[model samples]
Target: MEALGWFLFAYQVFVLYYFAVLNFLYTTFTFFGLNMVARYARELSELSLKDLLEREAYLPVSILVPTYNEEKTIAASVRSFLALRYPEFEVIVVADGPKDRTLEVLKEAFALVEVDWVYRRALPTKPIRAVYRSLAHPNLLVVDKENGGKADALNAGLNFARYPLFCAVDADSLLDPEALLRASRLFLEDERVLAVGGTIRPLNGARVRGGVVEELRLPRGFLEKMQIIEYARAFFLGRAGWSAMDALLIISGAFGIFRREEALRVGGYRTDTVGEDMELVVRLHRKAREAGRDYRVLYTPDPICYTEVPSDWATLRRQRNRWHRGLWEVLLAHRAMLFNPRYGRLGFVALPYFLFFEALGPVVEVLGYALL
Candidate 1:
């Protein structure tokens, strides 16, 4: 009975220490993140942005929109991409064989005419049915292809993308007017940047007009309100902290830009994992490290993309479950890099943090609750 008492007491102490350390790290990250965000904000002035645009020294980007069954909002989403303030970019909308009238909607809305635009297939994807270009907007191109997942659709876009850089945007999301200019500026300023991740805010309560968010307001639903906080912590605190340390792992697939050549070199997006975005970023880090190349995967706060969050309980639960699964999927895939010195800080610091604090966090939390 005495030995049992000691075991119980030790378990309780372990749980306490676990939470204390987690909270402490969160606090530290908050400080680092706030400082980094402030520094970045000061660095990017309106005059500098105008000067950069005036000089025309920006790298052109191909914006890829992968759609599955987005018939309702496809038109608005594409319009927002076309309305971006960037100088040179093409919008590639891959219709990943949606069951609805997604193609018809695009054809009617944008006056899409089927074109036989020949392009090199750098990455293998499901066969493309036809390619269409918009009469209203010359820069818009749509690829109608077989039913493939989101990653497969992105790969198809990569196959036909012509620009030196590509920005992946979900079909349901909208980018701010200056989003492209700000994100692409990173690559232009730094030669070593392989990718740049931008901030994503929930569009649940925003007033959107002309495919742009005109007003930002608190969401009415409890789920959406909670999501706003979750996103703030994850991106503003977690991502910014990791980025300041040069160890950012997951870049949201909804809005991330990559150097096209580097993406192709790393074999594009992997279709096998639900966590394709995180996996692709991880692979990029692993490859760069192995090659002894100096590269930076960055996360910045200025550029923003607004995405529709789950409004209902069932949908919210499903989305969170999928995200959690994705986290574990990525951690397992790169298990070899957990503490190996070969990958340096990524292995030693970032991976371990994700493994111990993020991945195993829930399991430990549940155990802690039971013990308490």
Candidate 2:
């Protein structure tokens, strides 16, 4: 009984230390992130944007949308992409054999016409049934393919992408007009920049017109309101914080731009993992480190993408569950980068932070609740 009591005491102490350390690290990151934001805003100005526009110092981009059963939002989302303010870009929407009227909706909405063209199969993916191009929008192209997961669909889109850079956008999300313009600038400014992740805001209760969030209003759902708070902390705080250290891991799948060559060199997205976005980022880090290359996967606060958050209990639970599992999958996959000095800050600082705090923190919290 005494030994059991001592063990319980130790566990309680550990939990206390865990929370303390976690909060302290987050606080430090908050300050670093704030400094980064201030410096970035001061350094980058409208004149720079105008200079890029005039000099054409921008890399042309291909926007890849990997979707399944997103029929309701596909049309509007495409409209928003077509309206983006960028010099040169194409929107490639890959329909991964949706069971709904996603294909039909896209066909009618975009006036999609089937055409045949040979392309390089840079990565293996499920078969592509047909390719459609919109007569109305020359830049809009749709790939109808067999049911593959989101990652596989992205790989398929990568195969069809024609630009040196590609931006991955979720079918249900809408980007700010200057999103591509702002994000693509990073690639042009720095050759070492591999990927740039944009901020994603919850779109519930926001008025929409032509796929743009016209007005912001608080939603009636309690969960939605809470998610707004959570999203803010996760992105603005956690992401920005890690980014300041050059250790930002996850560039959300909802919206992230990547250099096409580097992604293909890394073999594109891993289809088996649900956490494809995070895994790809980690892998990119690993590859860059191994090759002794100076590379950056960045998170910028400006370019924003608005997405729908789950409104109900069941959906929210499922999403959280998936995210938790995906985090585990990524950590396990890159176990080599956990603490090895070769990975530098990524191994010693970033990966350990994720393993101890983000991934295992919840498990410890739950166990603490049960024991106490």
Q: Please tell me which predicted candidate would have the highest lDDT against the true structure.
A: 1
**How many clashes (backbone N, Cα, C below 3 Å) per candidate?**
0, 0
TM-score of each: 0.97, 0.98
C-alpha lDDT of candidate 1 relative to the true structure: 0.93
lDDT of each: 0.93, 0.92
The list of candidate 2 runs beyond 4 A from truth reads none
Candidate 2 on 1-372: residue-level lDDT in tens? 999899999998888888899899989888988787777789778898888899988889999999899888899999999999899999999999899999999999999999996889999999999999999999999999999899999999999999999999999999998899888888888899999998899999999999877898999999999999998888887888898899999999899999999999999999888999999999999999999999998988889999999999999999989998999999999999988999999999889998999898888989888887
Off by over 4 Å in 1: 1-4
Per-candidate alpha-carbon RMSD to the true structure = 1.2, 1.1
Candidate 2 whole-model C-alpha lDDT, 0 to 1: 0.92
What TM-score quantifies how close candidate 2 is to the native fold? Answer: 0.98
Q: Give the 10-residue window scoring lowest on summed lDDT in candidate 2.
A: 35-44
lDDT, model 1, position 128: 94
